[model samples]
Target chain A: MQWLTIYKKECLESARNYKWVWVPLVFILFCIMDPLTTYYLPQILESTGGLPDGATFDIPTPPAANVFMMSISQINTLGVLVIALITMGTIAGERKSGVAELILVKPVSYTAYVTAKWAAHVTLVLLSIFVGLIASWYYVQLLFGDVSFIHALSTAGFYGLYIIFVISISLFMNTWTKTPGLVLFLTISIIMILNLVTSVFSHLLEWSPTNITSYLPSLLRTGEVGQDLWLASLFTIVTIVLLLFGAIQTLKRKEIV
Target chain B: MIQLKNLTKTFDKQYAVKNITFNLPSGKCVALLGPNGAGKTTTLKMIAGLMHPTSGQVELANGVKGDIRKYIGYLPQHPQFHSWMTGMEFLHYVARLSHIPKHESQKLAEQLLDRVGIADAKNRKISKYSGGMKQRLGIAQAMIHKPSVLLLDEPVSALDPIGRRDVLNLMEELKQETTLLYSTHILGDAEEASDEILLMHKGAIVESGSLQDVKERHQVDKITLRFDGNMKAYKEKMEEFPFVTHTDIQKQKIHVYVQNVPEARDVLLELVSKEQWPLLFFEVGQTTLEDLFMKVVNEHAMADHL
Candidate 1:
């Protein structure tokens, strides 16, 4: 119940700061622009003076489902950056400004305080992804061919988990440092390192969470799930839980000075 | 009532508050008197459970088991709030965190706003609030849970005179409801507002007692005489009087410590009239808290010097 109250305050703060509006706008813009440009690539290229006058090149227009999946893939990098940027300051800024001390000085439990922040960030990330995915579904169907609504929903759900994973890292880093900028830099750097390792050693790192980001688009195009998808997701879910738990313990041990 | 047992906090191999113990009885306003860096804030934070002591414990009188925080309402020296929030919203949020019912929180927040005299600005954003208004709002939020012990750290040290008077009066009324322990360096405010005093120096308590008791313990019979003439010469002449046990010159005033204040006063006045000394003022009373504070702090400094 105490967690719920804190969650509401967090949401209200986000709403007032225009985070709820602009973050989804960034997603919707990326999703809309991806499909619209892909559909008109041939004409857009020809108009730019086709390959040194008289040389012509063919550009393939993929299926609507593929275009929608491509947009999700683009969101893979930019979306993670957005999530890290917003979540970097949630805990660190409060602690720096002494607001955390005031709140924790009350009867509020450490678990309630940290978990509420985690839930709020997860809620906002999930909502923005849902809205952006729906908008992209409309644009892809209009410009290219047919893609099922259920396909988009499942893609959003899978990718939303990956985004929540990013948010969890930001929250964990926030507890470790007082500088929000450092939280942002460290979170992005860690994710980038994981992504690079997953690509370079795919078989060895099959059960890694970063593998899920690379596999989600293919899963949407074909009705096939990667062999390690379940294992990777299990790891991601467990990691998210562990990270939140680590955050709570860190906050408990590092009471305000 | 709250009992602090051997409370000690050390940072980076240095003691911020060291091996201090005191009990705060219920329904009394005790002032923790100390200069800056005397560890008053650290001691209060330890009691508020905002900081864990390197050693020792703070226990409530009832011996209640879990989470001593619910029973303590602490206002830091500089209170920081969510500046984007309205006063009403902040208080309501605090009340909800304390597990007050949603419907009741609104009413309680409003009532507290009126109690703290910030009701008029309840709807305004806290970013626009003046320092004193924020201090009052901080006090209101701390009391939202109706905690048994209210620990305020330098509540009025940052306020102007009017704001200080307002907070002092509010504290006077509040002591009737809960045990109030606040820290301050302003001796005059403490003298006017508190029932007891705890004088801390160099991270340890140097003195602790009720206002009357501490004063009586260090009581003296003295006459203070000020003149336009040379203060050292007057001090020398005054010391020769038989009733005048000793004398010291301070700020052009002669403090004549005597065995008998009445006999000393009569003799000093007669000598002044006969010699036509330029006596600017004459005061007969016990030593003020300012005198005691300087004496005690200087004594500690001299001890540390050795």
Candidate 2:
């Protein structure tokens, strides 16, 4: 019950800070930009007049699925950074600023505090990603060809897990340090290392969380979920639960020293 | 009521607060008094449950079984709030955290705002409030749950003189409602506002008792003399008296310790009259709390050095 109260406070604070508005706006912009550029590249290049005289370049229109996947890929880099940057300060900054002391001194449980924050961050990220996927799906249908709504929905779900995993990393890092800058650095570094290990051993890493990224776009292209998708999803979900539990324990141990 | 049993905190093998024990009786105003870095804040933090002690524990002595923090309210040295929130909004948020129902939270928040004298500023953003207003808001937020014990660390140390008076008056008004244990280095405020005093030095309590009892325990029989001219010659002359134990001058006033105040007062007055000394002012048997604080702290420091 207290967790729900705290969860509502976190959401209100995020809205007050315009996080609810701008994060989704950034996602939508990234999603829409992908299709617009893919469709207009040939004409944009021809109108520029910077190419050598009589020089020719053939640019083919990619499938709607490719455009949608490209939009998500664009989000995979910049949008992840935006989410991490926003979440980096949620715990670390509050703890350093002494606001955490103000709240934790109450009767509230450490689990409630950490869980409420985790839930709020996950909700915002998932909602924004879903809205972005839908907008991009519409643009792709108009400019290219037909891509099923189910594919877009599945893409958001798989990729949403990856984003939530990133958020978990931020929360875990937050409990380790009171500096937002340090949290951001550590979360990004951990994510980069995970991605590297997954790519270097793709054939062997069927259970790796980063495998969900590759499986998502392939699902969009082939219209069939990969055999490894469920394994990777299971792995990501388990990691998220463990990381959240770790953050709660870390906070309980730290205790505003 | 609350009791701290041998609580201690250490960082990197160095004690931030050494073993400290005390009891806060219900409905009493206790002041934790010390200079900066004397562990006053650390002691308060441990009691507030914001920091855990390396050894010992803090528990409610009122037969409460659950979390002691549920019955406690804490205000830090520099209380920070979400500046974007209005005064009323912040109180409502704190009320919700304390699990007060939505229907009653608004009424409690409004009442607390009026009690702390910030009701008119209820709708104003916290960021735009003055330092004093912000401090009042912080107090209101801490009291939302009507906790049994209220812990404030240096509540008025950051305020202007007027703000200091305002908060001190508020504390005076609030002591009747709850057990108030606050920390401050301002001896004058402690003398004015608190019923009990815990004097801390170098991370340990050097003295603790009711205000009247502690002062009486350290009380000295002495006469203060001020002259129109140089007081050093007068001090030397006074030191020659058989009953005078020692003599010290502060701010041109000679403080002469004596064996008996009644006899010393009569003898000193006779001498000043008979010798026709230019005595601008004379007083007897007045030992200020500042004098006791200095003497106690200096004595402890000397013992440490020895």
RMSD of each: 2.7, 2.3
In model 1, which regions exceed 4 Å deviation? A46-51, A63-66, B225-250, B254-282
TM-scores, each model vs. reference: 0.92, 0.94
User: Model 2: per-residue lDDT, tens digit, B1-306?
Assistant: 898889888989988888988888999999999888889898888888788889988889877744677898998888888888899998998898898999899999999999888999999989999988888888998888999999998999999998899899999988989999999989999998999999998889889999999988878888998999888888998898889988889898899989888888888999899999999988877677888888778788889899
For residue B180, give model 2's deviation from the true position in Å.
Answer: 1.3
lDDT of 1 at B100: 93
Instruction: For residues A40-130, write the lDDT of model 2, one tens digit per residue.
Output: 8877887887568787666888877888889888888888888889899888998998888888888888899988999999999889989
lDDT of 1 at A119: 93
lDDT tens string, model 1, B1-306?
899899999999899999999999999999999888999999999898888989999889999755898999999989999999999999999999999999999999999999999999999999999999999999999999999999999999999999998999999999989999999999998998899999999899999999989898877788988999677777888888888766777787888888887788899999999989999999998777877887788889989899
Recovery fraction of native interface contacts for candidate 1:
0.82
Residues A11-62, candidate 1, lDDT per residue (tens digit)?
9999989989998898888778789889888778779865776665667778
Top candidate on DockQ is: 2
